[model samples]
Target: MSAQHFVFLLVKNHTHLTLACATEPLRIANMISGQELYRWSYASEDGVSATASNGSVTLVQHGFGALPPCERLFVIPGLGMTDFITAPLLACLRRAKAGGVAVGALCSGAWILAEAGFLDGMKAAIHWEYHDAFAERFPDVALVRSVFVADERHITASGGTATADLMLHLIEQDHGYDLSIAVSDMMVYAGAREATGEQRISLQSRHGMRNPHVARAIAIMRGALEEPVPPGSIAEDLGISVRQLERLFGRYFNTSPSRYYMELRLDRARNLLLQTEMSVSEIAVACGFQSLGHFARLYRKHFGGPPSSQRGRIA
Candidate 1:
């Protein structure tokens, strides 16, 4: 069989991580197979270099108006995506679709596809942070929270490592499980995540609660990580008594609302510690801890180490 051609249509401020993940699988697949199983190139609307979200620039090999015929074309975009979608780019995608070229998107690039009317009546996936806004803007599209959605013609994946998952899925489809596994091993990837996996933890799973009110209350807490509301206020907002809320928490989670909230904040602090360059005190303040001493004490009690020590280990 001939090599499958792919063109990644990049936009300004494209997500560098997603782009790398999406393309690395193909490169690995080719190396493992010792064949040009997949060929890809970067393209831009005006044949210019595109700047990534991290300020990295990618030189384009093709302009949208002068793209080489390809089996698949993927739209990969990043932050400020709403400002990047233009008539010419949408027209190019629409024209490609009309010519029977399979189209896909990574990250918020699905927003451009939806604007082009290709995702109408289709189940699409975008990064979870944009779920509410995308749903509100594209009411006709079925915006799912899965890591990626592989519809008949339009494929969409949420950003980050989800792009890798989608690309691995496609590799398996095009070649076989053995080749896909070989490529994954070469990349040091543990395993490919299923496309149906959720982008975020469900409230029920996070809090181990079945009661709708309790789940809703926890969701509220998650939404207000930096500015926590009181448990009494949470109960009032949920139209339940504070005693009832406490009872629900005690029955299901075996913890009080205050304790659960503190755990959630600590979990966020741990993630920031491992993933970001923010200082311990900044993380404490960001997680809504008023006193750094109290934050350190509770953090050690919860995580079995001081925040400073945790940062040291992570760094």
Candidate 2:
């Protein structure tokens, strides 16, 4: 079979780690198979170099308008993705889709695909950090918590090593399981997860121990962030008393149930503040704060500054 061609459009501030993870698997596959299984190139908004978020610069072979025909085009964007979405880039993507080229995204590049209207009514996987804002902004898109989504014409990975997983899945589909395993073994990546694998660690693993009551209560808290359920309500849902909930929180988290819930809401508010273009007041309301003044005071007390001070900070 002919080699599959892939083009990576690296927007400014793109994550460097994800780019390496995406392309390295292909290179290793080719080396292992003793064949040119895949060919790849780079592009940028400008016809020159694209600088990554970590200050590395990649000299690209094409600009957006001059992108070469390829089997797939993967957009690699990172923090401040909104600032990099432009008319030329969107037009290029639209043209590619119109021409029947498969499109995909790495990291926060799902934002670009969503902005270009490629993800409407399609399931996608974006970096877990973008989950809150991406859902709020693009209600039409069905966002899954998986590492990658490949069932549709347009593919997306949650970034980081997830891109590598997606590439391995493609390799397995195009070649065979043996070649994919060879490539993975060569990379020393033993824990490469499948598409249905979730992006974030489970609450149980994160805490290093399992407690069903704590887990259930935290799940309730997370689900009701926008209209936070009271600790008593969460306890009732778990069929436990409020005192038991408080004792659980104090034992496992070293905090009270109310404080734990407040911290959860504030952390989400912080994520929205840094990740989205939402105003502080809008974020406060979205995070279940009815009084802007009260929210600001609590935010300052928790984070050592007001919510407005968090604007433009890198996530």
TM-score of every prediction relative to native:
0.70, 0.94
Best model per TM-score: 2
Off by over 4 Å in 2: 313-315
- Find the number of clashing residue pairs for candidate 1: 0
lDDT by residue for model 2 over 1-315, one digit each (tens)? Answer: 899999999998999999999999999999998999899999998879999999999999999998888999999999778888999999989988998899999898888999988899999999998888898899999999999999988999999999999999999999999999999999999999999998999888988878999988888888889999988888898999999889999999999988999999999999888888898889999999999999999999999999989887454
* Candidate 1 lDDT score relative to the true structure: 0.87
Q: Clashing residue pairs, candidate 1?
A: none
Cα lDDT of candidate 2 equals: 0.92
For model 1, residues 71-132, the per-residue Cα lDDT tens digits are 99999988878778888788889889989999999998888999888888999999876764
* Residue ranges of candidate 1 with Cα displaced over 4 Å: 202-246, 250-315
